[model samples]
Target: MKLFLYVLSLVGFLAGCGGGGVDSIADGDPSYVKVRESLREASSRVLDGLRIRGSYQAEDVFHVSGCESDSKEGGGKLWEAAHFWQIDEVNSGEVQSSIDRLRDSLEAQGWTIVDFARPPQVKNTVVRAQDPKAGYVVRVIGVQEKSRVAVRVSAPCFRASGDS
Candidate 1:
C-alpha cells in the first residue's frame, strides 16, 4: 500500500503539472460510454490509494446518476457518473489514514483540494478535490458509526454518450 501510494502520488503530481502522463483524468465533450469508462477508471485509481488491511468490494463498478434538470449550451440534458468504494469496515484511525492517502494522491495528480474537514471531534467528514481542467471531483467520507471509509468520484456534467 505504501509503495502504491508513493507511485500514485508521483504520477498524480506529474499529471497535474501538465505531464499528461498515465494518471491524467481529463475529457471534453465525452459521450455516455466514454464518461462511464472514465468514471470507473477514476474510481478504481482512487481506491488503489487506500491502505486497507482488509479487502473491499467494487462489484457494481459505478452508479449512474440521473441527468441534470437543466441542459447545456446545446440544450441537451447533462448526465452524471459517480460511484462509492467502501472500506472493509476498519477503525477510525485506519479510515483517516486512507483519507490522507487519497487526498495526497489527488493533490499529486494535479487535482485541486477544494475542501477537507476531519475535525478531531467529528466522525463524519469529507475531503473534496476537483480536476482543475475537467471540474470532476472526488469526495472521501469517514463514517463514524461504521468506522469505515467511502470514496466517491463524480465526473462533470456531460451529454449522453450518443448525443452530438
Candidate 2:
C-alpha cells in the first residue's frame, strides 16, 4: 500500500509538468489585458469596426531564452511569453486600406512607426510600431492579395520566477 501511494504521488507530480496548468503566459503581466484591448481598438478601426477575426490566440511560456520549448505543448520555465492573432477572409483591396488606416491611427496616437516593408516575394504589407515609453511593440501584417492580416502585441521582457 505504501509503495502504491508513493508511485501515485510521483505520477501526479510528473503529470503536472509541461502543462499550461502550472503557470499562465500572462500571469505577471499587469498591462497584458490593457494592451490587448488597445490592439482590438486600433485594429477594429481598420477592419471596419469588426472585432478580431477568429478570436484565435497562441500563447507560450518559455523556460529558456532564445531557445525552443522541449515539449510540443509549450511549457517551460515561464521566462518569456507571447501572444498572436490572425485575421482572414478580407478583400485584397480592403487589406491595403485597413493597413493604411491602422498606420495612421497608430501614428496619431503617438506610436512611432519603426518599420514598413512590402517584400516583392511576399504580398503582405507589414508595419511595425513602438510606443513612446517603449513598453510594448506592435506589428501589423496584411496580405492584400490574400485578404489576410495578423497582429502581434508583445509585452516587455522580464524574468519569471518559475512560480504560478
Residue 141 error for model 2, in Å? 1.0
What is the per-residue lDDT of model 2 for residues 1-164, given as tens digits with 9 covering 90 to 100?
Answer: 22332333234323332233434334234433343334344433334422234322222112213223223344434233333445667665666666677777778878888987765755678888877774556678886666677766555544333422
Model 1 Cα lDDT, one tens digit per residue, 1-164: 53443344334323332221232222332464476556656766677766565446433244444456546567445566665556656865777777888888888889899988876756577788998987778888877667767777788876653354
**TM-score (C-alpha, index-matched) for candidate 2:** 0.54
- Find the candidate with the highest TM-score and give its number: 1
Model 1: colliding residue pairs: 12-108, 12-109, 13-108, 13-109, 16-110, 31-161, 32-161
What local distance difference test score does each model get?
A: 0.63, 0.50
* Position 51, candidate 2: lDDT: 28
Show the lowest summed lDDT stretch of 10 residues, model 2: 55-64
- Per-residue lDDT, model 2, residue 164, is 26
